[model samples]
Target chain A: MKYVDEFRDPVLAKSLIKQINILVEQIDFAKERPIQLMEFCGGHTHTIFRYGIEQLLPKCIELVHGPGCPVCVLPMGRVDDCVSLAERPEVIFTTFGDAMRVPGSKKSLLQAKADGADVRMVYSPLDALQLAHKYKDREVIFFALGFETTMPSTALTVLQAEADGLENFSLFCNHITTVPTIKAILDSPGMQLDGFVAPGHVSMVVGEQPFHFVCEKYKKPIVITGFEPLDILQSIWLLIKQIAEKRCIVENQYARVVQPDGNFPGLDAISRVFELREFFEWRGLGSIDHSGVRMKDDYARFDAERKFPVPNVRIADPKSCQCGEVLKGVIKPWQCKVFGSQCTPETPMGALMVSSEGACAAYYNFGNLPELMALKAEREKEEALS
Target chain B: MTASVPGMRKRSGVLRAETINMSHGGGGKAMRDLIEDVFIGAFDNNELSMLEDQARIELSTLTALGDRLALTTDSYVVDPIFFNGGDIGKLAVCGTVNDLAVGGAVPLYLTCGMIIEEGLSVADLRIIVASMKAAADAAGVKIVTGDTKVVDRGAADKVFINTAGVGVISKAHKISAHNAKPGDVVLINGYIGDHGAAIVGARGDLAIENDIQSDCQPLNKLIQSLLQACPNVHCMRDATRGGVGSVLNEFAVSSGVCFKLRETSIPVRTEVRGMCEILGLDPLYLANEGKVVVVLPKADAEAALAAMKSNQYGVNSAIIGEVTDAPTDTVILQTSFGGERIVDMLVGDQLPRIC
Candidate 1:
């Protein structure tokens, strides 16, 4: 709490807000009409929702949810394959909790588990290696999921497994790069992003350089922010200032944790274990080239997909679930028909409801805008009046 | 003494369970067998007579609460050590208190044991310890005692925290999952699944920043408030490892009552929903550290909400669902669009080491 409390100093936050307000007043930010700020980190998106940061902004400023959710973007076909692998009698599929609920061709790993398949949930990829060591006769397949932030651990686990000669273990790699997903969002016709709140955690791995492409090519100012209320507020203020000044540059606000080049050994681990895939199908983004990482040819034997015969299956998103639009910043979470009515967390209709980083979940949990709170109050008043 | 039915034992190593075994939770003969064979025989505690249901203790305190309180301890072995919103320290304190808070007691004190890996930096240890102290302070509890053990570099992760808490509960505050009654309104402290997502994001190797931090805080204050405001509060549960869905199912099984939750009423963050989608995780099944589910009589529901909202930790509290008579022992979710579906208990550890 020592390092944490200092960053969230309400007094400093006020001063920073005052500075941002003064800067904005000087540039007449209101005249910009609509300043669209897209946060590339799922964390930033959640922070914005959690604190009602978007509602606190001026009318001209709008924070858009970008392609920050990795789980929501996972292609249905790949999920089906994971489920297929999980269903195999000899194969014990180990995955993070998120991967288990993703629907694939009418089935999920949870369903497979309910049907008596050997599907297990683990905290980390290393846990899968531990499982492999525990069950030598059984083939342990780690459903390697997440972005650069989580990929390093999986890579380390793989390198360790191979070095230790744990032949029964393998990884079903679905690690996607952040920059490509950002590009995909920027390229999309519906994307009206003016700037980006770059991911802090991912930047801790790939470094601030990877996001340079977004700034240089897309001409958008990117602010890498820590995952805290004040960090997000400061980042938003920075983005607003950049939009007002018509400036485009990549910035790092989370300087304490994220280094410009990132951790060399962590990057080395990822580079050694994974090879860029030419093309991978994202759940909503379609096939984006070089967006994902697969096990290198040398490590194919430890690739769960290669080690086992998996049934290729593809499933459509629930017809009413507008997760694609939600992810692309085309619409807000509440805009979806299934937002709260049909797709609550208890009975999620789509991947957005399943993943914790999904924008919809963020809104449902923390996006209690003043208007909604007021509405609830009004409802109570009306009840009394009646 | 014929060794109390020769408790359950593993054929191999003490830590390692041979096969995907079920000896861990064995009942009756198997349960005693496991305790004697693996636990009692190895770590021979004087108090662990291996009572089938619980470990009993007698205390000499004279108060409104019972003389004897059920005290338990556990260590969080979550991976990635530090998470988006919090670290293992906060989780350790809160998780320990939740065990007591949910048991209808005012968590009074705690003891923390830190297992630090050799190479772990002093900075990280300080952060975790600071978080533990902050969590304990927030819960209005103290770290009465602690121990620090440094293992070799590979022996443990950066850190693991084991915590034991002591609580005092009166007969009036005696809440449990089995106390849920038909026609009780089920309420949650706030949103669900933030802690799990925050931890996942903290891995820092993931591209997306799940800026959400761990909702790891003690709910004893909130529970005490609720007990004061509405004594009809029949049940209380911290929606931890199994999330809301599984917790509801557990209540249903224990109380022999059905639960029906509204889709529109349950709170979740849009970002969390999006991340869950991308990651293919169910926010319902994901863990929540600072959240609690309470079952109160319909008449006292509003009062309970008022009490919860007044507390700092329960600002966004909501009545997510209600206990029902239908189905008797099953949990059902009413979809936002008016469809009904079954909500089952989690079968396996969805996110293990999630604390």
Candidate 2:
């Protein structure tokens, strides 16, 4: 726990909290509106909720959970298409466990498995490849989905398959890039975020270069951050300090893991295997140009989408759901029309309610009880006064 | 193999096949010999030696102990049947005994039923049965009646065990999940997540090398001692499949109260916490075999904790949390970071995220 315990140190966290409190008091304050700082990684959202960091922060600072969970942003029809591929007689479908419960138009992969589809949960692409090797006659299709942090591994796995000349293995690539997606959210007509805590691992592969656009164009201070409590607190301090001095730059708070110039071999493997698609449909936000990747034409033989036939349809999000608004920080998850009523973790209608990394799920599962109770009391008091 | 003692029941000849066949469960002589040599041979009590379909118990003896009968059942299907500390057989017995023990019962008799795959090794079956016998003896409960069935080779994993237990609950020991009121202190017996971390590592899925072993043991004697020291204990539960988080949630929801857990006070081994961190899982939801969550009033907390600390299973016992009146039907954890968040029941199976 050397690497982990050091980052979660409560002593260090309290010291950072005191500094944050002092910093906030010095900055100009608006009573009506809180300064919005978005953590642009689902992993960070999970850390925030798991450690209850939001409660410990000053009232002026609000952390908006961003759209970083690959499973949470996966569109419904793509899941249905995955199920369609999984149902084929000779096909063996494998995916990460977090993706298994995501709802397709008709059913989830877990439900499809109960209905006799050969769907399995795998930890890595290599496990799917091993399955392909084990079942020679069966077609093994990996449902690959993630950001740049995970993209390199999938690329390396495909390269491994090629080196070994494995024919039966292929990836159903739905890999999306976070930079363009974050750009789309920033451009949307909603709450204007003051700063960003950039995804740490994604920056480890793509480097800090891609995030320069946010700093230069949007003038938003972006700190590449880690998931530990102290790491997050320290990153927030960096962001606040930048705002106080009127400077916006791409800085790396997680310098222990991410470099200014990312790993070259990882980027090379990713570029060699994948190319950006014209457009990719997301669950909450609609379709974005060049937000997703597919296997290069040269690597088509190792692509599951080309190897198998599927419906490949697009299903619209529910009318009442406000996942888009939640994604853009326009609305809190509980303010959404269908949050607990129609959209729950058990029978989720929108993508946000489906994964632990999603804002709605995190709020529902681990929201600060005292804060919620206080909010409820305030609302009741206001109604009584009115 | 010869019988161990003189005038013992006759022993069947050594098993013919290394693995079992369909004939072993066909309800014929092969099935009889398998049951007699494997189960009854190891579980050699007078009640089982009678070879009857059902066990006969004296009503007077049952009534003399308690006014109510606590009947409970549990099924065991743990993978990697043999782990570092225990096997599925031991888990099956401990699970049932603890279920009754937490209900303030004096566990008396147990009925075992097994569903085994056709290709399971006969020697493995004997070893499992031997483990079950040892656990039953430790709990002072007799395995009186049993049944067995073998399925096709691919139908079952290796073996699955189901145990139904009957115990006498005293009239004065009134215990329930809903009985906990505000001001009640929550206590746990020993370190959490030993069994869960042990099983996850033993599954060999992560290829992690850890020396953690399963904490699979019966808690009947320890619980009986706690009640002897403090009889007004409001609620007690075995934190098994869903761990202490789910158990606390059930208590909160049932009692219309809240539980405030201190992360610093909750007992978890550093290695177990490390394993959970690696898998992106919370140790609160991991399964435990030899763990109990007890809630009692402030006055009895010290006595009960002292009584628990003296027992072999309760040496690491600590007051982890307290029942609260606010935020009805919720459980909150005061994180070691000095921040607080609600701890809700886990939805779906807890799967290790691949990020």
Say which candidate scores most in DockQ.
2
The structural similarity of chain B in model 2 to the true chain B, as TM-score, is 0.96
**Top lDDT model:** 2
Could you tell me how far off, in angstroms, the CA of residue A132 lies in candidate 1 after the best superposition? 1.4
A60-97 in candidate 2: lDDT tens per residue?
99888888989999999999999999999999999999
lDDT of each: 0.74, 0.91
Question: Would you list the clashing residue pairs of candidate 2?
Answer: none
lDDT (Cα, tens digit) per residue for candidate 1, span A13-66: 667666766766655546765667777767676556544556545556667776
- TM of each candidate vs. truth: 0.58, 0.96
- Enumerate the chain B TM-scores of all models: 0.79, 0.96
DockQ of each: 0.06, 0.74
**Cα miss at A162, model 2 (Å)?**
0.8
